[model samples]
Target chain A: MNHQKREDLVKSVLFVFSITASLILLLIIIFLFNEAIRLFQEVSFLDFLFGTKWNPEQGLYGAFPFVFFSIMATLGALIIAIPLGVSCAVFLAEIAPGWARDATRPVIELLAGIPSIIYGLFGLVIIVRFIKVSLELATGETILAGSIILAAMILPIIISISQDSIESVPKSFKLGSLAMGATNWQTLRKIILPTALPGIFAGIILGVGRAMGETMAVVLVLGNSENMPEVVKQLLGKEGSSTVMQLINQVPEILFKPGEALTSAILLEMGPAQVGGLHYSALFALGVILFCITFVLSVASNYILSRSQISVR
Target chain B: MINSKTSDKVMKGVFWFSALLIISILFLILGYVFVEGIRVVNLSFISDMPKNNWREGGIYPAIVGTFYLVAVALLFAVPLGVLTAIYLVEFRKEDNLTSIIRISVDSLNAVPSIVFGLFGLSLFFYYLKDFTGGPTIFSGGLTLGFMILPTVIRTAEVALRTVPLSEKLGSYALGATKLQTISRIVIPSSIPGIITGVILGFGRAAGETAPIIFMVALNPTMPEFPYLFSQCNALTTQIYYLTSEAISIERAFGMAFVLISIILISNYSARLINKYLARNIRR
Candidate 1:
């Protein structure tokens, strides 16, 4: 073949290959929804989403407990990870010596590379035991346990991305702040952080998405009990105490109790649920819900990242 | 000025402590696992099969199974990922199609691993059950392949982007077609980046447990050699089962040690390869 024709042929082949990622994504959505919609036929969409009970054996499939716990765990993780991760990023970006920075990078990378299963095992053996003994709970596998593991799991992602963004802030900004009688901390707090806020926000969103979708570590430490926290039930119940102080006092009890997450719900039940059955379809619906949540988060992250890049440039 | 100075010092101390705490977590995990697991990880453990219903013995089958799964995942992912990346970097312009493709790739990366498992179970295990023989290594590997595809494409694209424009222009000036320029100038210069991407993908596939759990069964006995269409075991799944069952804590730690070692070594080697390649390209 002529060179032009050969080039055309190669281009078309690569084009087909290029579209495969999009194609696979399309297929995944279609397949998940196709199976998930079947569950709606058996159970109303609102009932599936908002109903509280999730006993599959008797045909009750309320997913609210799982959704509530997943959100709580993710929020808990964010609270723990954000402050520590941002401070660590600042240290690496502006304060750490070159050798220290170099040494820390590989450690973080190795930490990130450790599998979720290992994290789960570590949590199961160590964190759960520690929490059990310290908190004097019947079981240590609670929302707090899951959140701690998730915070650790997502810390690397937050630190690396936040560090990059912080480092990318224009050197001129820092110099100008310092020249105007600003202390190093003052400049970092006012100038550098605001400049890198979009990127850091994007990283935190990505971490939230990860923590929400995390399965193995969460499943191992969450105890996989499909029940709403007792505090939430009390608050919503008619005769429960309405005092703010009392509610505040119950927060620790809520966190210490065992719960379920969306990802763990699917993982633990996938095996016993017969294929094409309502149980299986309900799980796929959960998958659909997870897909939508992460999809939005991912799109938002990409949008912020792109916007930040343009602004920086 | 005195008050501000004291506050700054306190803040600096906080940052240092945060950094130190993060690093200490890594060391703590490593130290805990190695101390408990190292005693159980002798040559016999590496080579021998699990005996007495996985309560005692080495994880040879799981080790072999992880290798096969990673190998198959790489086979499916590398070519498609690299080629797709080539098209994105070389052929595509800034347009709606490009943006859509980029969004899809990012979205795919963000999709939960368990969701991928569900998709795999639906498509490969049920729809194509006859072809895949239902929950075999083939299905599991393909599931992992899709799971890691975005990582491969994104990394390869960055690598391809790093090849200087001048080198491609010189190839074109020498009467090379686009295909020839890419093959001769672009790919050769960006090989290290592509290799790095592949290595990263391999580590990811090997370490993933959720995507493979439903598609592959835990084979207590050794799988038939080279049986791609049969149920198989993997290190990640084995660790999951062992720990969850609380059968043998020692064996679980040993397997976790093995899995972590593989991932860390691969990540370290990829970094080294990229460093070497970057220096060479500059020269």
Candidate 2:
């Protein structure tokens, strides 16, 4: 009876400790919302979400620019990363020999472990300079620089997860395709990739979440400008050219212009904003927006990942 | 048939090119930093204090501060994480409460590091200012603790799950209690994995700059011996400051090198531990 009581006590204690993660998460949501809700009282929700300007000093609190930049940078990064990451994943999963896979996996893990700040530094010293000198831009801290850095930062996640998913397509699938006299590439493209699509999609969504939330590297290389990218204005203005030609000329300009992201705005302004003031609340509100976006993405990815795991099992 | 063969050849080339591209990028970053920063990494640079407005001298204080913050973070995280992993692996049933805990862990892991910084500033700096000394190492460390908690829990849980059920059965056959089997048999077998988790968590905490920038790290100062209740510098924040302010490029590279070295070493050692454990388990 005494031993049984002790066992029950230990189990209960462990149970309490296990709930610490839940409790901490609860506190985070409560505190973030509590602080963020105060801003909606001052700024209308629609205005905060859709307003174009973000001057906190004049109390404009327009967050659209940062949101736009976040999306733009994430899209740009995806454009660069998806092909590279997926192809690398395919290579490692389907083509690499045992020793090559073993060697390459650790290198990728090391790349993932490198601090984001170092990536920021590398972007500043190498990428930004290269851009400035080669393109003769006023400043090298363009959305392109940020995207490049982010692409590298997010590559490991995409590659590793996609690789796992691709590899998990049962050997029988490949064998069956081969038995049908399909080419290796055809086997992969038709059988393996389609089966792994959900998992790969989950990885991509997680990568999007990562790109959206990345702060330090973006802060360094994004130039943190509040103005809309010049290309957007040019395209919108439709200045003195055929629409198709104007778009072709202006599309590349988008990558070269300085921009601010939601994460960068928070990191840059949190210091200057007065405590418990509107600016401070607005920053927290930005956090709230970021939190909501990443939370939804993560939950969606998790759901997809779990479903895929179940299907595989 | 010719078309199919050509397409396969082209796709194969593309795949190899992509893989090579990634490997080259990694080498380029590492090699550039190593070459630019190797000159400034002698013993004195590691031991002395900054002399001229952070343009000259060493990064001793920042190094110490990084270790201190990671130590404090691990102090909070390891116990909570290991215990939580223990509960999940050994005691959890397929129930709502367990599901809730699992979801919370995943959600917490998904929360951005910057958001955690904001949350820390609000909770520790504004609300619990008196207790946390309003953005001290204690507050920053705790914030990081929360940020890396999920990582620790997940890795430790993986390790704990790998311990064979037959080992526990044998313990029970000897009339051992569940607690005894856990403490003596399960934990002993999983120590290497648990240590790997702690080391990986340490690497993460040490590398993180966003969560601590506002909460704890301030302008570089000689970190006092017992500076838990005071603001201090960190290697990561130092790199951020150096590059952002254009204070000293060489020093920034040097700090980046040191920081990368620490992170890479921890990561490699964790892999080594995992490999060793796998071998032992197979045996």
Candidate 3:
């Protein structure tokens, strides 16, 4: 009886620690939104979401171009990463010999373990220099530089998740396809990819979440601007003397401007901006937006995971 | 059938190409860091201090700082995390409170580390200032402790859940109490998994630059014994500073090399422990 009572007490204390941890997450969301909602009162939601100018110094609090840049950089990274990541997963899950899989698995794991700061440094030295010479540009920190580093950083996550899904396809399914006269490659391409589509899609969404939340590394290479990319504007045939056109030209003369994305904007503003200022609140507002987007994406992926018949989770 | 054969060949080529690309990217990153970093990372460089406004000398201080930071983080986090796991696994009643806690933990796991930085800045700097003081090693460690809580709890829970029910039943059958069964059997069995989480979490905390950026201050005066309230420099943040400023490219590379080695060794050790654990379980 005495021992049982002591056990219950110790267990209750442990329970409190665990509950406190979860409570902190709820507190973070409420606090971030609490700070962020201040910005909404200062600037209408439409202007904050769609207005083009982001000269917070001039009290122009538009953040749409930063949003556009973040999306473009993330999409650019995905364009490079998806093919490489998905293919690598397919190879590891279905094609690689056991020895080969063991050898390569550690290498990819090591790649993932390499810190983001190191990647930023590598991009700054070799990639930035390479891009400058190859593209004939004055400076190399651009959307492209950020995208390359991000793609590398996100590749491991994509490969690991995608591979899990591919391997989880029941052995009977593979044998069935082969017995029906399909080749190994045909079975993988026709049956396996389709079956694992939801998992792969989840992996991609998670990768996007990673790329979007990334700050320190992207900040190092992307010049941290609030303007649109010239390459994008040029491709759009955007040449005129209108306000938007002038804004595009105002961006430094380069194929890709040294630009800031949304996260970088927050990082840059967080340090120097005075506490409790509108600028400070706006940065927090940016954090709130990011938190919401990632939260939704994560919850959506969880839904997909639950909905799927296969237990990728 | 002929068309299908041709498509198979094409798809096979694509898969092989992707595997090749991943290997090459790995080699490129490793090779570049090693070649560039090896030139500056001599014994003296590792053992010395930053001299001449950080243009010369070694990175001894940053190494020490990272050790204390990681140690303090583990010291605070490991106990809380392990306790939480024990509660969830051993004492959970499956009621609404328990389910809500589980969901919140899952959602917490999904929150990005940078958001933790923001909250850390606000909580430690703005709100919890009375206890945390301001921008100290303790505050940074606390912030990181929060950041890594989900990792520790989830891994510990997994390790606990893996313990067989028969072992507990056997202990009870022998007249040992529930506490004795847990302390003797369940915990001993779970130690390896908990250690794995600690090491991985340590590696992550050591490498993390975002979470502590605002919560920790720069100690320009050099590394004396770190106090809870004193500032310190870490390997990752120092690399970021050194690279951006280009103050000393060689030192930045050297630091990068060391930081990479720290994480690599941690990962390799985790793999070894996991293998050893797996073999023991089979027996």
Report the Cα interface RMSD of each model, rounded to 1 decimal.
0.9, 1.0, 1.9
Best by DockQ: 1
Superpose all Cα atoms of candidate 2 onto the true structure and report the RMSD in Å to 1 decimal.
2.3
User: Model 2 chain B: which ten-residue window has the lowest total lDDT?
Assistant: B216-225
* Best-first order by lDDT: 1, 2, 3
Each model's lDDT comes to 0.90, 0.89, 0.80
Native contacts, share recovered per candidate: 0.87, 0.80, 0.59
What is the Cα-based TM-score of model 3?
0.91
Q: How many pairs of residues collide in each model?
A: 0, 0, 4
DockQ of candidate 3 (2 decimals): 0.61
Residues A141-253 of candidate 1 have per-residue lDDT tens digits of 99998999999999998998899899889999999999999999999999999999999999999999999999999999999888676666666563466677777788877
Task: Give the number of the best model, judged by TM-score.
Answer: 1
Q: Give the 10-residue window scoring lowest on summed lDDT in candidate 1 chain A.
A: A232-241
lDDT of 3 at A137: 82
After TM-score superposition, the amount by which residue B41's alpha carbon in candidate 3 deviates from its true location, in angstroms, is 1.1
TM-score of 2: 0.96
| lDDT computed for candidate 2 | 0.89
lDDT of 2 by residue, A75-182 (tens): 999999999999999999998888878878877887888888899899988999999999999999999999999999999999999999998889998999999999
Q: Model 1's CAPRI class?
A: high
